[model samples]
Target: MTTQMIIRLDSETKTKLTKLAQAEGKNTSQVVRELIEDYIQNRDMGSYIDDLWDRLGKKLKARNVGSREIERAIYESRASKK
Candidate 1:
């Protein structure tokens, strides 16, 4: 399920990565992949849970929003401009 990826890095960075991988009993590819996956997951969902809290706060301070309110917000936020 994974394809080849070619990356270029500075000599020091490459050496560091290789050393870290060896210390961890992993290869550079595996370490980089794991790091990239974790980074991507956090970047994607890191704001989602925070947004839930923000929305819940809005609901509490003003009035608790029902499911319909959330659905409307979601729709408006993601709807195409065109």
Candidate 2:
């Protein structure tokens, strides 16, 4: 689900943004969405960690490492900490 947000910008800024967005073959809203997504991806630690884990999972799968190996590793790691 998506919600609407209202932001206030000066005329000059709005005009420039519109022109740039057009030049990039996108609407102002798309540009704004991209900016917001990038901002969140940069500053959100949870998002960063989730992406990291996703990449790691992909690499492990590529190497044919299955859930059993992952579970064993996790169990071993926890045991080592005790």
Best by lDDT: 2
Clashes of 1: 0
User: Per-residue lDDT for 1-82 in model 2, tens only?
Assistant: 9999999999999999999999999999999999999998999999999999999999999999999999999999999999
Which pairs of residues clash in candidate 2, taking residues 3 or more apart in a chain or in different chains?
none
- Per-model root-mean-square deviation over C-alphas: 8.0, 2.6
Tens digit of per-residue lDDT, candidate 1, span 27-56? 999998999988877787767788788887
TM-score, every prediction: 0.53, 0.74
lDDT of 2 at 19: 100
